[model samples]
Target: MGLNAPLVSPRPSDGYDHRFTEVDYLRGMERLVHAVQELSLARSLSDIQRIVRTSARELIGCDGTTFVLRDDGICYYADEDAIAPLWKGGRFPMTTCISGWVMLNRAAVVIPDIYADARIPHAAYRPTFVHSLVMVPIRTLEPVGAIGAYWAQERAATSREVSLLQALADSTSIAMENVRIYAELEQRVRDRTADLERANEEIHQMSLTDDLTGLTNRRGFYLLGESALRAARRNNHHCLLAYIDVDGLKRVNDELGHDAGDSLIADVSEVLRTMLRESDILARIGGDEFCVLVTEPGGDTARLKDRLAEAFRTFNTTQARPYRLSASVGLALTHPESSHTLDELLTLADELMYADKKAATESRAGGVNTG
Candidate 1:
């Protein structure tokens, strides 16, 4: 298409005339600004690419156009047409080629006649029948990409046309920068949401864990106990709670160091966890107190107690340590008809635990070893 064909604006004063009226220049500037706004508001990268190609084709009045961008240290042409394949999928070092030259120099280059300009290497324009071309770097101070338009017929580009393309290139730069900033902001928002979710999960875990033994703490125990009670009350089934108190833990802490005391607590917690069912809840409430909430009331309660005793036996026999890990356990059963509240049931279990501890102490004083 002819440059002054009026396709873009009113025909430029007929013929090889390079001069432009002041009104024509202002109208072209206004059109360039409108095109830039349209491109900037594009929703996706694909949409932006389409708009860029169409804009270049219309603004520069070329038969074919090529749009290219640099990403990950590699240059890629965004066009799919096969007529002008400068380096289709072939790598061009950013130091060479008209597009690369414009990118590196960060300025617009206009060639009135491609064959006459010494800078226009002959081999570059040989593939396409293009004789005259104009290249404008689509960027601000730092070049991000370039847009090139080619003509099949040999014709000289006017100063007004070159200036108009430069303005359009500048608009392209702003649109590209705006899109980049928007994408970065979206990515940052996603990253922040993921970080918040991770932090919330960690906080939840900490709230349910005991600081000393790494087991479920008192708050965890009550929460689990309440849920179990509600389930049993709903189904008219039964559940049990076993309150356990470790024997002679305070004496060990006083005689040895706090590290030894911590080791003892951790070992006991591990034993309890290993002996219980995966569905059961094991929590450390006080310095040497723990609670296990079993789902079923009758047979499972007895089985869980046996498992706990076996775990302690195995630990005492395997370890060469002088101090023994032992506990007094008290059981409390809850049924649908039971009148006791959750707290009341726990109080009854605590009283039974004290009775067991008293009986164990009496036996120890009588020089009778339960083990």
Candidate 2:
């Protein structure tokens, strides 16, 4: 008979001693149990894979060992050495290989002698020089991945060796679960933090905007205007503040209802937002009143007035309502040598606005109506 053929052991004089001696078997089992306990404490996947590689190499006395994980239907050798390159991220159809078959069935496969087994398909063993193989499905609540060990020469795997491998596979399953749970929890935390930041930003924006016309309210205007004035002063730059008042809003509201008046205000706000440069600030400071801060060189009042007039004309053409959109604009320029507070500047601008309103009304009624 060939050396590769199955051997029949001689019968011992003592029946119990014929098999493995009790003391030797117990010592081996104790060592395996300790090894499993050590593997269970591994926190990360890399740690678990390393433990698996080292433990398998020692326990099975194989030339090399590999650990693979199943992603979709494909097996990737998450950790392996060159001696068993086929085990590392190597692709094999489920119908063709021992590892794939074990994964599909969710059971352990022991090939005592790969060459002698008829159930073992020929094509599966063609990629590597593996002759003796033991594959165990690393089963969790759901099947995760698989672990396998192989010998270069054909041989029978001892029962104790198979038991140790199964224990190691179980340890790997638990470690994989821990790592997956940690990763998912970390992702959830990041998603929640991002969602909260978005909500806070929206709330902050709502607090700064006027409810009536979707423009910056009085409080927001003062806060922003003061900041802009300070910045311009520090940089030795010029800024223009234009205070505007709707000429006949009270009459329009009394005759056409507050809803129509509100619609006209919204239309004006949209026009001003569109006509001004993105750097300029447009704000609603009071009923039928708004303010704009324009930062530009030369401080051209005529250009600013023309832009306002164009915006008014656009609103008149686009709006379907009967009431016309008209505003009296009052502009003030900041000077470095002047000792004018923001409140004082605002008062001057307000006085100028009333003067413009008076002139506009007088001009409209041919110097008769000067309210």
The local distance difference test score of each candidate is: 0.72, 0.72
TM-scores of all models? 0.73, 0.78
For residues 257-292, what per-residue lDDT tens digits would candidate 1 score against the true structure? 778888888888988888788878889999989998
Deviation in Å, model 2, residue 21 alpha carbon? 12
Runs in model 2 deviating more than 4 A are 1-55, 82-84, 112-129, 140-142, 335-344, 362-371
lDDT of 1 at 324: 78
Question: What's the C-alpha lDDT at position 339 in model 2?
Answer: 59
Question: Across residues 155-263, which tens digit of lDDT does each residue of candidate 2 receive?
Answer: 5555555666777788778777877787788889999999999999888878888998888988888889888777777777787888888767788789999888888
> Which residue pairs collide in model 2, if any?
77-89
Shift of residue 272 alpha carbon in model 1, Å? 1.4
Model 1 Cα shift for residue 356 (angstroms): 3.1
lDDT of 1 at 98: 71
